[model samples]
Target: MIKIGVLIPEQYKLLSVAAILEVFEAANKFQFASELKETFDITLLTINNQVDSFFKTYKTDTINTEEKFELILIPSFTTNDIKNTIALNRAYIPWLIKQYNSAAEIATFCTGAFLLGATGLLDGKAATTHVDACAAFSAAFPSVQLKADKTVTQDGRLFTSGGATSTFHLLLYLLQIHCGKDLAIKTAKIFAIDMDRHNQSYFSSFQPLRHHNDEIVACAQEKIELNYQDISTIEEMIKDIPSSRRNIVRRFKQVIGITPIEYLQQTRIEAAKKLLEQTAQQMTEVIYNSGYNDPKAFRKIFRKTVGMTPSQYRDKFQAR
Candidate 1:
């Protein structure tokens, strides 16, 4: 049985927590159908051994790294929580280290990367956090190699992400690895999320030096140019890029100043913008050809990133 543990702090992003749980639940359902049995044992863990009756924070009753855990997930916490817990806390840190030492895979969503950074386990390891927290993450733990364009990254046993919504990406990544690609696809559909809406693999090689590192960035850039109409997995990208996954993530973030996923999001948005500006294509067709299945989600991401709705962007561009 795969024992999955989630370390929760107060006021954690409910969506991320719920997403992880749902993915596992889906996996459990699949396993049950396949073998007529549950293949997982999931536990919600906390720091102290006290259950807060009001908020329903259950106490962590035990720690036995001897029992193998397939995955350990940590959701994002506040900045204050990151600082206070990273440097000073041994209460859960040691156990976390123990889990790392064990065969269990570890992953974080959003700012939860801070806790992994706290363990000093990420020294020179590829990881990511919510883009808004990038500066703070780099400043706080310079030893950690932070990637910019990724929604999630997997460096050996460690995994991480850059935002609240990226939690879905992280879970899907794990599902592909542990459960199967088909299940990941199904889960994405079940949730009405665009499977191709975001590309976590792009951040594998993003960099801060926009113009200087043309050699490496161009490789990824060319692939995007050639396959902008088609999307591939991270494994497929690695096969084409000739860089190890970790090295790609580390170097890409250094050159592009954004994670690969961010770049892809930007690229797709830019493409959508251009289509919106120059073509008479309907909104649904624009979104579909651009690789987004959800028009509402497309509008939301576009408006959030571009500062206007698709209609607004088209109107302004048309007027110009």
Candidate 2:
């Protein structure tokens, strides 16, 4: 039997863990009423026997440091407090590293990449997380090649998926490699999964952090956000601020993980995305209303950022 251990850490997302259990259990029962019996031996390993009460009904065991598995799955955390969540579950880092060294394949769902990243196994490896958390993940693990646009990414035995529903894609990928394409397709069909999906950038909404105490950077951000429709550049926008342009740029990048100009572009792109999803206005109107003066540059930037043409994005995300 293929043994798989799903780690049940504190603050884990219930849906992530539940979906994983459901998939493997369903895999075991795929040939129900036959002499084939079950195939996968699924186990839940909890952190200090402290998993969420929601999983109490499931048979679980405390993490056995000496136990080994063919594969381990890390579930996404519930909160956006990724840093603290990583620290809270720091005990799993060494276990994960040891498991990886012992030939166990590791898979992470959405924000679970943050935990795996803390172990340094993801260093220099291609990985993806929740599209909205890509910036924070990149800042935390600069060595990891963050594929923010991908629905799923794999490097060596390490696998990661972007956002919520993308978890099933990774599960299907794992099944495709280990079991067979047919089983993968079977699971996908059971879940009604659209196997064609590969990009998550269009689902991303740029939300920059504003909790930093850098007043100069704050002022710069304020000017860019409030005056995004204005024809003023970053340099012109920051003229009224007390600090020089160089200092402001440095602090802005330090605090926000992006340059002021890039932040403005992200803001404008968010505005453009809302327009695309909410309005039937002409393309030129979207361009101008979102603070772009040129249609060519806007389309190019939109495609580069959102991973689709404006029309395609609208067609996919626009309300019926």
Quantify how close model 1 is to the true structure by its C-alpha RMSD in Å: 13.0
Residue 2's lDDT in candidate 1: 70
Candidate 1 lDDT for residue 27? 72
* Per-residue accuracy of model 1 over 148-251 as CA lDDT, tens digit each: 55667889999997786788878888888876798788778777766553433222221323356457666776565555556645455556777787876676
Each prediction's whole-model lDDT (CA): 0.71, 0.89
TM-scores, all candidates, are 0.59, 0.96
- Candidate 2 local distance difference test against the native: 0.89
Q: Candidate 1: misplaced stretches above 4 Å?
A: 51-60, 64-66, 78-81, 85-90, 197-320
Return the top candidate by lDDT.
2
What value does the lDDT take at residue 68 in candidate 1?
54
